[model samples]
Target: MAWFRNLSRFSTINVSRRHDPFLLSSFNCFSSNNINTNPTIEKPSVDPVQYSGLGPTKPHEKPRVVVLGSGWAGCRLMKGLDPEIYDIVCVSPRNHMVFTPLLASTCVGTLEFRSVAEPIARIQPAISREPGSYFFLSNCTGISADKHMVHCETVTEGEQALDPWSFTVSYDKLVIALGAQPTTFGIRGVKEHAIFLREVHHAQEIRRKLLLNLMLSDVPGISEEEKRRLLHCVVVGGGPTGVEFSGELSDFIMRDVRQRYAHVKDYVHVTLIEANEILSSFDVRLRNYATKQLTKSGVRLVRGTVKDVQDQNIILNDGSEVPYGLLVWSTGVGPSPLIHALDLPKAPGGGRIGVDEWLRVPSVQDIFSIGDCSGFVESTGRQTLPALAQVAEREGKYLAHLLNKIGKAGGGRANSGKDIDFGEPFVYKHLGSMASVGSYKALVDLRQSKETKGISLAGFISWFIWRSAYLTRVVSWRNRIYVAINWATTLVFGRDISRI
Candidate 1:
């Protein structure tokens, strides 16, 4: 009855009675069945050839190339890639590419986490047919090299936490730029207790966990020893990440917590334990500078190997136990599971994939590997390029050039001369190393021959250089501005203690 009533609204009201005779005549003829039954065949419409939105590019256009990972290598490759030639697609688990150098700063509240993260979908050669063309395959599990498809499991935007959260994508040419992760070395308790500083999410989790520990230490019923343990932040590995985190943690204690929780200031401490002397990778001069600054900042530097990480303490190789509230492990990297799954040939010492000068896989000519995961040999010597943003960036650009060339040739010829041509063996020009020590001191290793030539920085000068270089290297103008604003705000009114 409701449906009929709703349909009743379609009654045709007569506006002009002058046309009533014609209507009545037509109705009468139909009632009398005087209509001739004819089989009328109607031709369907033939629309003229019209182009849709950026319709799959011209036939002679570049081949479909897909890049995996949005880290330093993948992002840079996409950035440098030519739009006209290759139909570019970037698939990664993370939607945003984190500028990992500044990740520690974000955790310690020196910078906003968002400032260090550049959305992968935002930066591309041009606004693609698909707005999210820099496709975020957040659930990527493995690669089907045989099928030339990325076996992914991704959730649509805003539905990540829900149960239905996995999808796959097909690709033509795939670039594996997936970087390395922190290696546990089969060490027990390392995986269970030690926090890592690999991504923006890790930084965020660490920040939240650190804040929680601080707040819980201030609880009324908690004992002083427990509070002490809670406030002691022990960092393993004296590399740039560990050193920077220690420095930032020290500053946080002295600057923010001391003024607010003066009683807890004495309890708060940061200790860095390294197998060897800190910053083992850096030049001795720079390492010494960093050590001196760290010591002066009241961070205890323990020179020995860590035997094990327990519930609330780190046991050193020398039979000494140091109680810690938070244990951060920034030790070293190993081959990612994805890379290892490929069963590619690896170097002896490190398990990084082996390649010749052009950056291609030894067996798989079309597939290219770069960043921390790739290992290339030179005519002069063998060197595994350290997993750094700089290295990844260069390799990515180089890969883009090779890919462009391959597309131009219409996939007729091999891009490089060697079976695994990793582009002239990727000689990493040591552009010096820098460590941010507490206060206004930062140790700068000026290995470069330019204006900053071999100068060690201390006080405000080193700090300025460190800030400027990192800010310059940050991905986008919007992100750089946000970081600058956060820095200015922190200087003016101190860090906001809000957590979400």
Candidate 2:
């Protein structure tokens, strides 16, 4: 019995060592003479010391390039950067980059959520494998341009017991690609009531709420008025996101809801409220076609401004009440609160961080800004580019090449790139625009601008082109296959309505 008890104690110590690697080393440090003979002896427990953060790189180490966000701009830059020349460190609240174009499809079961998300590790493998490169799941709180450091706090969302902790990272070059936030225009209850279709979680919430409303409206003893309000879907904004989502919702109703929830099929409806013309950026003809297409698909297009949002309905500027179970706000984006807090030079109109032709922040050394967070300085006499994904992506690609050139020229260090020639300035040429409006229909405008005359197509042919273009543009082949499979599955099996 004594030998068995000793063996049990040894096994318990071995299990503790397996759980905590440091326990084995600490146990080994105790000599036999120092070992406690009393089996009931207890030692005081001390909490483990928390890590501070990464310090400034030494002269012998590779210069660190710290990126702030994982959106289209930041992800593109990371993908194009040369890992051999510099160590990359990405800090963002989320670990994945969302494909915003197809995000609307995910809300209505046209495509699965995972198909529209690409992990940051897959985008830049060096961050996970390289000795110095890293990807921190945190949000940048502040930037110290003079000291070349950024203050960040970890994102501990959904883990109620674990409080977020702060850390600092020193960088040789800092790229600010922090994306913009959805603009609410200071409307009452916009933030609390209306859901913005930006992140993966937002789409998931929309799907869950939509499914729940559908199921609840069909329950017995529910009044007709209640069922109508519960099944009515409201979308505010005339942009591509709002229009595409309305289209997708209508498609789901016509195909899935009518067949699955036959009891309340007549109650399901989609209403799109836009103050101005839909697809305003497209050609006049394309906008007209989109309008006709949406009208034909049983979508009620209302031209009214939203005055207030309530729990179960919205008040329009004309004193009319529009009741809905689901309200999605996509009224475009503006600079985030961090951008407003930063004491940097801003552009003329949009309040974005001001950058020179080389995408470098004007008065800051070893710092650059791209994507929706950056704009050309007023002194440059250049118009601020429109906030579009294509613009951000191209800017990211250009900056990546520029940074690679600087690194090769021995300028990839703090305040060492002053003498390097930053070649020709970045020039953005408008690429084209495309939007899908359900029922196997779409619009494609290849014109450089609304003023320029280029090839513009509408109907089924453009729809094919739209799908083909985005399919090839998906970040990875893995996600491309996932999206393709999801689409095929949806077409054959109809959307997987197992609301797990």
List ranges where model 1 is wrong by over 4 Å.
Answer: 1-62, 125-134, 155-170, 377-381, 412-427, 448-455
Tell me the whole-model lDDT of each prediction, alpha carbons only.
Answer: 0.70, 0.87
Best-performing candidate as measured by lDDT: 2
Q: Which stretches of candidate 2 lie over 4 Å from their true place?
A: 1-51
Candidate 1 per-residue lDDT, tens place, 1-500, comes to: 21112112212211111223342332223322223243242221222231011122234544566777888998899887777765676666676789888888888788988999898656784524532234644545776555555655444346433222223444446678888889877777998988999998888888887888888988899998999899888898888889999988888878898887776778888889888878766666777778888888889988888887898877888889999888889988888777777756675467777776767666664677888888874432567777777888988988888777666556612233334332344455757777788786787776653344465555568888999999899989999999999999988888766667
Question: Model 1, 208: alpha-carbon shift in Å?
Answer: 1.3
TM-score of each: 0.81, 0.91
RMSD each, Å: 13.4, 7.4
Q: Write the per-residue lDDT of candidate 2 for residues 368-404, one digit (tens) a residue.
A: 9999999999889998898899999999999999999
Q: What clash count goes with each model? A: 12, 0
User: For model 2, which pairs clash?
Assistant: none
* RMSD to native, candidate 2: 7.4
